[model samples]
Target: MTGQVSVAGLGPGHEAQITPEVSAALAGATDVLGYIPYVARIAPRPGLVLHASDNREELGRARAALDLAAQGRRVVIVSSGDPGVFAMASALFEAVEATGRTDIDIRILPGITAMLAAAARAGAPLGHDFCAINLSDNLKPAALVEHRLRHAARGDFAMAFYNPRSASRPDGFGRALQILREECGPGRLVVFARAVSTPEERLAITTLAEARPEMADMRTVVLVGNSHTRRVGGWVYAPRSATVSAPASDPEGDA
Candidate 1:
């Protein structure tokens, strides 16, 4: 019998958010592997082995799951949110490519990603076209992050930011706020959503003038509205149409 590898998403910290396909994969998996907290979300049972590792070891974890599949073990690699959205899917494929393994069957199961989940909880702040940006500079250069932010702002696209801040890069979020304030101005709406679907979830909505960089943490996903975003009663939303007028672009067209 041939072995298989399934890269599955756990969604945003809630069992209810996990897809039926992912649940089925977990139930049939002989081995489950993921970051420590994500692996802990899976229940232990007979004939199943769970391998949990630290956060920075994504490539190692991906390679291990591929190896287990090659050894005829049905393996599931778990990631929070969708595996393809800044998660394990790319790493898995990279490992598979490096190993040149074609005999093992590989599958990716999608789940509710953090930005969409956060937007839902905040009343559709991403209703218009938007760009999802990873604010973490661990894998990319900080200059590129700044460059993308300027372009996203210039285009007047709503923005969703992942991994907004961490202890290692304490001032990154602060600088991001400065750029947004300069480009989008002080009135644009910003939403800070922490741990969506979990008991500890918290949501804050404010304008650029009132938004503080300290509101975001590694656990938080920040959303910045396009020029047309606004608050209706207690909820915030961007209109579905881009016909709404946006702020004037800088002279060079890249703010």
Candidate 2:
């Protein structure tokens, strides 16, 4: 398979956060494919073709990258954060699996995801056990989101949430905040890291009682600390270790 398809992460809005491996993939790519804003990060050069599409077209975009590779084009699918983390890598693999394509070289180049970036900016709230949850209900049922939130809270796991709000689903985040308040209580720390690493980046650390739903938009990544999470100075973090406790049962009865 001379033709290759590389799924690369551009990191969270900053060129500095992009990994060297992803940079190499982009350099060698003949065709770059991704969402409009992600693709716009790449500079136009001779022999490189840019294919920008709208959001919510992951399958189509993945297939297009695969088809281009089949035609001997060195294609790279760019994702804003790590392609593996709720990004193009999964969609690309899904397309490859469905097609049973064994004739093309496929590579997944990882990048620093938004959660990690946001966590770093917020002083390591994910220093201990953590779970990353995508709060959007576009692909999954809304009930599952609440279920996962409850489980994560019951597990006492630090959580990083993505896609907290969007124009079509503004109420979902508010409901999520409500579920968190019910489970984690008012004193739990929440960090709203908006546009991390970008010029418009803003970080707000507050307790659940003080955290308003309006603080988070689509660009924001919200982090909720476990029961033991606390602030040292200006930073919030969960310690590396925690005392063992009996596992909490799910509030919802098993069917």
TM-scores for every candidate against the unseen true structure: 0.96, 0.95
The lDDT, on a scale of 0 to 1, for candidate 1 is 0.92
Task: Give the top-scoring candidate (lDDT).
Answer: 1
Report the C-alpha lDDT of model 1 over 14-122, residue by residue, as the tens digit. Answer: 8989999999999999999999999999999999999999998998998899889888999999999999998999999888888888678999999999999999999
Q: What's the true lDDT of residue 236 in model 2?
A: 92
Q: What local lDDT does model 1 show for residue 241?
A: 74
lDDT score at residue 10, model 1, on the 0-100 scale: 93
Local distance difference test scores for all models: 0.92, 0.92
Residue runs of model 1 more than 4 Å from their true location after superposition: 244-255
Regions more than 4 Å wrong, model 2: 245-255
Model 1 has how many clashing residue pairs? 0
